[model samples]
Target: MMDRRERKRPAAQPGSRRRTAALLLGSAVLLAAALSARPVPHEVVVQFGDDVSAREAANALASLGATVLWVNRSEGVWAVRMPDPGEAWRLYDRGAERVTDAKSYSST
Candidate 1:
């Protein structure tokens, strides 16, 4: 009885609100999962001066009950995993110039 141009269209055509709510709920779940995730206690990279050798650096870390995961002989840097983070100071006393966390750049 009314002209098509004068009649108003349905606000959302139906089911659009449900789809939008599902999308929002999925996004919230993903956000919560990401926020709860944590990184492992990755090893530390010990940097020594040029005067230090790879073997010497390894030995220094070994004395602290740490394990040498890898050795970069050319750069005089060793990736070592200590029992605790507090051992970084002892590394300085043992002749280490710098100690930094060895973090992963890529995610699996």
Candidate 2:
């Protein structure tokens, strides 16, 4: 006689095939939704210094419609607010950092 374990039937049956297909379709739909759903942040800038050079850079960035957070004369570098992690690189030349956090942003 065959061992009980060896005589066991296959896990999948023709009747359950439809259920398996439905489950696979459901998972695909969910994955697609998750991949497509994401938020895009708005960008702004906070310039530091009012000197000719600083003002020039500020004016250039102004056309982009970035909000000015602050202008500090004490520091010569400009502070631009990035809408997202991707745009943060735009401020590398002048120096960029997360306003809320201490993360540093620089090209080098």
Count of steric clashes across candidates, in order: 0, 0
Tens-digit lDDT track of model 1 for 61-103: 8887787787764857778777776666788866688787778
Give lDDT tens digits, candidate 2, residues 1-108: 898888967687667988988999999999999877754444343333344366566664464444555555644444444435354445534433322211352323
What is model 1's C-alpha RMSD? 10.9
TM for every model, in the order presented, reads: 0.52, 0.33
Instruction: Judge candidate 1 against the unseen true structure and give its global Cα lDDT, from 0 to 1.
Output: 0.75
lDDT of 2 at 16: 95
**Candidate 2 residue-wise lDDT at 106:** 39
Clashing pairs in 1: none
Report how far off residue 102 is in candidate 1 (Å): 1.3
User: In model 2, which regions exceed 4 Å deviation?
Assistant: 1-6, 10-14, 40-108
- Models, CA RMSD each: 10.9, 10.7
Local error of candidate 2 at 63, Å? 20
CA lDDT of every candidate: 0.75, 0.51
